[model samples]
Target: MTVNQQILLDNRPTGEAVESNFKLVQSPLPTLEDGQVLVRHHFLSLDPYMRGRMNESKSYAVPQPLGEVMLGGTVGEVVESRHPKYQAGDKVVGMGGWQEYSAVDANVPGALRKVDTTHVPLSYYLGAVGMPGVTAWYGLVKIINPKAGETVVISAATGAVGSAFVALAKARGCRVVGIAGGPEKCSYAVSELGFDACIDYREHTDVKTMAKALKDACPDGIDGYFENVGGYIFDAVLLRTNAFARIALCGMIAGYDGQPMPLANPALILVNRLKLEGFIVSEHMEVWADALTELGTLVATGKLRPRESISQGIASAPAAFLGLLKGKNFGKQLVKLI
Candidate 1:
């Protein structure tokens, strides 16, 4: 019999999660039934949206119940298999939750995808080539809809998703300006990721100044704003959008800390005729394959690069997740169990 450690929801958090919000518990591995595979999780993906799950509120995704294992994406190896579709030693990517091991029915809804790690790291299945990459692709092409020579501004520019947007937009002949929290991230956004310019929001006094810096970097004006931070950055860019600008409203990390929703600048929306829209990645699963194919080509050809801030061990998943919301994570944050 095999036992494994799992992080369970200790209590629903009020605002920012503390370490006490979760607890480590030991549980016996489930018996492998027919058409099931017992997996030893190797990598766990910690994303900003997980923070919303820790609360007892409702959203597009179901809320995490107390005493249940925290929900997340995991990439792992099959230790034993009863299903013909998967065999022992197969690597997979799926919503394996925050458990050291999980028993997944091969026929289960949204069952894991088998991964080929012969050429890439197994963790990339959770980052650049996975959900985040899909998100960037959809937001850029479907939502923002950048035209050639247009200016696109993206927040969190060096992150897995953000860097993907930067590279993809540039490839389409759009000018890209990225906003990150620190000098290191800003430099990486410009020097390595090849952004037209980058603004270190941490050093700037206010969003207006940062927006002005972006304006200077993009003298023509912002045609598209890929918003990750909501409060000030949204307000700043809203004031500078050109006529018929598009806004892809993604994660709102700035307002996730229990802050009241920032006042809407509807007047600007009316004047600029801006199109602001939000999306949940689950809603766009139909296009996942297309996103994967396009991003995979970019990656294989050395056009796209992804950075990850990795923590060791499944136990570190909570801290890594907390760091993501706090802007401590440089890119996609993950925990490697192996």
Candidate 2:
């Protein structure tokens, strides 16, 4: 492709992100250097983390620069390559951002890597067998560390990371109870994702009701927790947490749009002696290979079937992403660039 269509962060969000915050632009695809590769991206990953990057405020990572392609993971074909390690038609994954093509300096380690699609689908590299999968694995295996027969709870249970977390936790013999927004997602968590039970947060709008639902679903008490959405749902989980329970503080989507989401009961941490830890999966890259191995096998063997909500083209990214923040997208959201 000679021209690259791109999404640029036009401005930071005031509160909730809107389409106007992003601008669609066209530019000549960058000319590749001798050690660079030109990749034609087929799929671009849309994730909740991108919301945090939209703000100019300090965060776990730097804010995405204005008038540049919005950053994201992508999988595509290598249409042209001048690097010795890569060649034309090679299927690869990289941080190709929000664009149809990327001129990558392949010599930069981890910027580009070939993927095998023999058993696993290429898109799965963006969700279940990729970053989301590794996020689930690290939190459960490294942080929570639940034992067999213990009950573990996850919020945003049907989401990309939550679905993977459920599968991985189930494999370790933990009773996984999921918390999702609506009845549909709750049912899917149990019937499809194999959660022991799933509490619909819609019905239980407050802490008491949600805590009661947790009490019923996890009769044994929550021994581990993988948190995504915070706010009252997290408060309810805290009320049901067992002594010395481990908790992985992942995404707090409930507060992502500049909302206040403070813990209702901070004393519970001391009362329950909770071991809560927040992490960035990228910082702990050492476990990626091992995590991807198990996650790939799960997807390849039909053990972990991840759902996806794919938008048709790059132009749809802003709207699709806005929908994702509103919980409209079911699972891993992507923009199909091809």
Indicate which candidate wins on lDDT: 2
| Model 1 bad stretches (over 4 Å) | none
Give one digit per residue, the lDDT tens place, for model 1 in 47-125: 8888877766656778888999998899999999998889899999988999889989889867889988876678888
Instruction: Report the alpha-carbon TM-score of model 1 versus the true structure.
Output: 0.97
Worst 10-residue lDDT window for candidate 2 reads 254-263
Off by over 4 Å in 2: none
Residue-level lDDT tens digits of model 2 in 29-124: 888889999999999999999999998888999999988889999999999899999989999999999999999999897999899999998998
Q: What does candidate 2 score in Cα RMSD to the true structure? A: 0.8
Q: Tell me how candidate 1 scores on lDDT.
A: 0.85
lDDT of each: 0.85, 0.92
The estimated TM-scores of all candidates read 0.97, 0.99
Residue 179 in candidate 1 has what lDDT?
84
